[model samples]
Target: TESSTAQWANEDCDTQKLPFVCRRAGSVSVPAECPHEAQKPGKDIIAPGFPIHGIPCEYMLAVDAKSLVHLEILALEANPNIDFLEIYEGTMGHNLLANLTGTISNPAIYITKSANVMRVN
Candidate 1:
C-alpha cells in the first residue's frame, strides 16, 4: 500500500534494494581503549579490531539510578556467518534484548525497557 496513509510492515530483506549512507575514511576517529564498563554517556563503542578480525569483547553501559540508557547503533558491518552482537537487558546476559548480525541498512535504536542498565557483547 504505497499511498498517503501507508502502514508499516515487514518486507523481505533480500528483495529490497534501499538507499544507504556511507562515511568516508578518516571522518571519525576510533578510540584506543575499549572499556569493559561504561558509565559516562556519548562514548562510541567499536568492535575490537573492526574491519578485520574482530576479537570477542563485552561492554556494559549504566546510567544513574532510575535513569534509562539508550543505545544507538550508528554503523554496523559484520560477517553474518561468523560475527554477531548481543544486547542484554541488565548487568548480566540472562535477559537477551537483541542479537544483530549482517550489515545494518539503517541506524538502529534500543531503549531500556525495565531498567537503567544494559550489557553488550
Candidate 2:
C-alpha cells in the first residue's frame, strides 16, 4: 500500500489504487565488459571508450562523511532512447537520485542528501 506521505508499504497491489512507474528495455544493451573503479572528489568520471556505443562503466565516489558530494555533469552525449547515466545515493545504489541521458545544454547539478558516498553507473 501507499501511505499519505507517498511512500510504499508492504501490501497487496490490488488493495490500493496507486500510480506506478515502469521502464521497458530498448534495443541498446548493457555493456558486458565493464571496468570498475573507486574515485574521490575532483576526478572526472567518463564513460570508457568514448564515441563507442555499448560501453558502460561503474564508479564509486567516497568523500569525508562530514561533507556532501556535489556532482556536476560537464557534458553528456547519448541517445536518450537508449543510453543513460544513473546516480545513486549509496554504494549499493538502492536509492536513485538522478538519471541522465541525451544531450545536455547546461551543466546539471546533483548533491548528496546525507551520505558522503555515491555510486555512478
Candidate 3:
C-alpha cells in the first residue's frame, strides 16, 4: 500500500504515499508536541522526526512512531500546487481529503484552528 499510495512530487496527490513530504526532505522540524506516531487530538502535538540522510530536494515521509494514528507530513521536492492531499491516518485509518476539506500540511496542525483545511505552502 505504501507503494501505490506513494506519489511523486509532480504527480497526483490522490494516493496515500508521496515521494516527498514537504518542500524538501526534513523540511519540518517536528516539535515535541506532535510525534510522528499516533497523536492525541486534545493534547500538545510532538514534532515529527526530520527525514534522515535527506537529499537536497528529494523528500521523505517516514513513521517516527509505531502506531496507527499520526500525521506523516511529506516535504515536497519542489513546492507545487498542493490543492489536494492524501491523508493516510496510517493503513485503514487513512483517507483522501482535499485541502479545502482536509487539514493543513503542518504536523502541528490541530482542529482547534479553523476547521477548514488550507494549503500549508
Candidate 4:
C-alpha cells in the first residue's frame, strides 16, 4: 500500500509491480549551526552536546590564508554508524581531509593541505 510522506501503511498479500516515483532535485534541508568557530593555533572544539545525544550541528575552523590549520583529535567517543565527524580541507566541496568515526584512544593529528579553511561536521 502506498502512503504519504509523513505516514506509512501496510497492505495484504498481493503479487503486483509498483511504479517508482523519482524526483529531479532534493527536498530535505538540515539546518547546520556551527557554535564553535575557531581561528587560534591550538584550539579545542568539542562537539555540541558531546558525551550525550548530540543534536544536528556543524563546526567551522578558519585560519590565515597563508598558514595551514592543524587539527588534533585528543579524544573521541561516538557511535560509528550514527554519529560521525568529517574534516574537510578547503570547503565542503573540496578535498576531504579525514572521515572520523568511533572511539580513538591515541591522539591523532592532521594538517590541512590547503591553508585557507577547514570544516568540521
**Per-residue lDDT for 65 in model 4?**
73
Candidate 3's TM-score reads 0.22
For each candidate, what is the lDDT?
0.73, 0.70, 0.30, 0.63
Model 3, 1-121: lDDT tens per residue?
A: 1221232234345774776554332233344223334333334322232222212211123333432233334332222453333343223323332233234354433121212221121
What residue runs in model 1 are displaced by over 4 Å at the alpha carbon? 1-24, 31-33, 36-39
Between candidates 2 and 3, name the one with more favorable lDDT: 2
The residue ranges of model 3 lying beyond 4 angstroms of the native Cα positions read: 1-37, 44-78, 82-85, 88-90, 93-95, 99-121
The whole-model C-alpha lDDT of candidate 4 against the native structure comes to 0.63
Candidate 1 lDDT, 10-120, residue by residue in tens? 545567764533323443443334664564689777664455546677788888888887999988897886788898989867888899988997888998888889988
lDDT tens per residue, model 2, 56-94: 777777788898778889888888868888999878888
In model 4, which runs have C-alpha deviations exceeding 4 angstroms? 1-39
Higher lDDT: candidate 1 or 3?
1
- Per-residue lDDT, model 3, residue 41, is 34
Tell me the tens digit of each residue's lDDT in model 4 across 1-107.
21112222233335544453333233322223345435466756655443333665655667777988788898888798777778888766478888888898899
The TM-scores, one per candidate, come to: 0.71, 0.66, 0.22, 0.63
Q: How high a TM-score does candidate 1 get?
A: 0.71
What CA RMSD would candidate 3 show?
15.5
- When summed lDDT is taken over every stretch of 10 residues in candidate 1, the lowest stretch is 1-10
lDDT pick, better of 3 and 4: 4
